[model samples]
Target: MSEADFIARLRGIATDPAARGLADDVAVWEGLVLTHDMIVEGIHFLPDEAPQDVAWKLVAVNLSDLAAKGAAPLGVLVGYSLGDAAWDKAFADGLDTALRRFGLLLLGGDTVRVPAGAPRSFGLTAIGRAPEGGAPARSGARPGDQIWVTGTIGNAGVGLAMRLGEIEPNETCLAAYRRPQPQLTFGQAVVPHVHAMMDVSDGLLIDAQRMAEASGCRFGLMLEAVPLSAALLAVRPDVVDTRLAAATAGDDYQLLFAADPAKAPMIREIADGLDVPVTVVGHAGVGEGVVLTHKAQRVPLPERLGFMH
Candidate 1:
């Protein structure tokens, strides 16, 4: 199918105000909104992976970006690389499933075929409306703000290991990589109070460092306090270094946020109400480097904390 035809098909699926036909030029609402993400085969996923999972992931990854910004999903535009007709249908079915699962709709999309023997790639451009007034940005974190992460880190990393056969696939670990739940509800619940917020896609340490750099602050993480899933513990009980690597590894789509000290109680209350685990990993300080304090001594951190170019 051609890109225009794919888009026309999507236009028929859902109708939303933001997605209504535009005459080539249109003015959008102001504030922090709109997010786009692309995933390529071999880089983001294996070429032999299931088409349904790939389709779900394409949308989920983009939605994760919006969730990090505390934005509610408005709609999506899919950009696909054409393949077999049956495969394309499966992909569309998966995309529809994700859209309904997240209360998002497919506005439009484009599709194109890659040359034979070329690398495969797909992209999803997600549009979202910032909550009420504005969306959270990485530059908003302040000194003394406590850093917290929703759910356990490193599950996706561990799941990747399982995919590579470096580790055995367990129910917990495989679930992390295959179906990551974007913290949309959590982001909305905390948007009003968070000083700064971001989703931990590129590992906690690296993403946290990025947040620090953007906010002109430093982050201090207590290595002992970082949370790990039971599957991770079972695989490598004494592998502190592996845990640290997972903490810095990419693909875990959980939210890492900072908030004022005064709002700690409220944050806990919200987490409890939502039944999501929130861990206070560290604190933001008035400096420019990420410090990992372990056993009262500063540890030499990894040179590349997360995904690197």
Candidate 2:
């Protein structure tokens, strides 16, 4: 079955309100926010990548979920697939550095040895203290709310291309592909002002469509309004195709949110105070799914929206 199909089936068993009908990135219960993410060799990361970077990616991705929910991380339980002794040690060192950097605890976990030569895989469950107002849900977006995204889109996708030697290498793109920084502080600060929020992991377009669907509204996105970094523009021309490619490229762990237009000044103020760049990419409407436009002209949806499992 497809990922959506699998989730639909599992929803029956995950009836708790915290499950968010299996429609959200994290589960919130009591006063805590919980999320789990797994990465695998050759899929989530290049096989030749360093163990340290891999470990960091594993941790950052899970925390990205908490960041979307405006949660302050508490700790993590690791699910490790044992591999070479030296590699495992390096991963542990990297994990220690990441946990220290984020002020998170290494609670406890299990380790396993997979079959010989199997791809290395790791999982992490991150627990965090929910924001005082409560964690935001993807289903909370409302019509007339403006859609905002943190940071630029498609840099990580470009980074992946750079890693594969398809494009010239640049530190900006390379680092983005290797190490994605979750917008935790921004997510937390902006939560009270946002009507809905989520981290863009799968692609901007696909994730936006999900938020729109969950919230029972339509998202009208302006292609030109989708932010592109100077580093990305240095390599590719400013064109619709480039914008579309960036919109559909996954692995951008930036926050995407919706808020009242009246909250624009406050949102901008928060972003300015944090020195983080944010852009108004779209607005919620009284329909379903996502609609795109460029230079005021309608654009058909791309056949492939983003990464799908």
Candidate 3:
């Protein structure tokens, strides 16, 4: 079964409200927010990819979930698969770098060794404290809320192309794919102001649909408003496909959020304070599902919004 379908089945048995009805990325209970994320070799990363970056990606992805909830990370428990001695050593170094970069600690973890030739898989469970205002949910968006996104989008997708020889490697694009920085500070600073929020691990379009579904609202997104980094456009042409590709290419860990239109000035201020770029991409209304538009004209939805497994 698809992961979403499998999760739905489990939701019937999860009794705690902190489970967030299996809708939100992180679970919240007793002022603590918990999140777990797993990355698989060949699936999430290329086999030749540096072990350090793989380790960082595993930790960063989980921390991104905490950032969505505006939770301050306390520590993380990791599940690691032993591969080779050199790879393991590099992963350990990467783990240390990521933890120090994000001001997090390695609490404890367990390790196992798979059969020879097995792909490496890693998981991390991050524990954090919800901000003073409380953890914002994915289901709290209301009608007439403005949709916003932080930082740039689509850089990582281009990075993947560079890695695959579809294009020449540039430092910006390569770094984006190898290391995704979670917006930990911005999430905490803006948590109190947003109605609903989540990180864009999946494509912008897919994740927005999820937020719309959870909030029971219709999200009208402007294709042109989806931010694109200069690095991506420099390698790829600036056109409709450029924007659409970024919207549908998952892996950018930027924050996607909903807020009141009146809060735009404040939101801008917060972004400016952090030197993070924020843009208004759309709005929410009393309805179901999402609508895509370009230059005020409705556009057909892509056959696939993002990665699905």
Q: Rate the local accuracy (lDDT) of all candidates.
A: 0.80, 0.94, 0.92
- The residue ranges of model 1 lying beyond 4 angstroms of the native Cα positions read 1-32
- Backbone clashes counted, model 3: 0
What TM-score goes with each of the models?
Answer: 0.88, 0.99, 0.98
Question: Rank by TM-score, descending?
Answer: 2, 3, 1
> What order do you get sorting by lDDT, best first?
2, 3, 1
lDDT of 3 by residue, 31-74 (tens): 99999888999898999999999988998899899999999989
lDDT of candidate 1 at residue 168, scale 0 to 100: 76
Please give, for residues 1-309, the per-residue lDDT of candidate 2 as tens digits. Answer: 887788889998999999888788799999999998889898899988888889889989999999999999999999999999999999999899889989999999999989999999899999999999999999999999999999999999999999899999999988888888989899889999999999999999999999999999999999999999999999999999999999999999999999999999999999999999999999999999999999899999999999984
State the displacement of the C-alpha of residue 249, model 1, in Å, after optimal TM-score superposition.
1.3
The superposed Cα distance between candidate 1 and the true structure at residue 65, in angstroms, equals 1.4
lDDT of 1: 0.80
lDDT of 1 by residue, 1-309 (tens): 786677667767635534323211111246435666788888888877777888888888877877877788889888899988887888788887889999987898888988987766887778777788566667788999999999988888888889889987898887788777888888888889898887888789988887898789999988777888878888867455866877887788998898999999999999999998999999999999799876556877888799752
Total clashing pairs for each candidate: 1, 0, 0
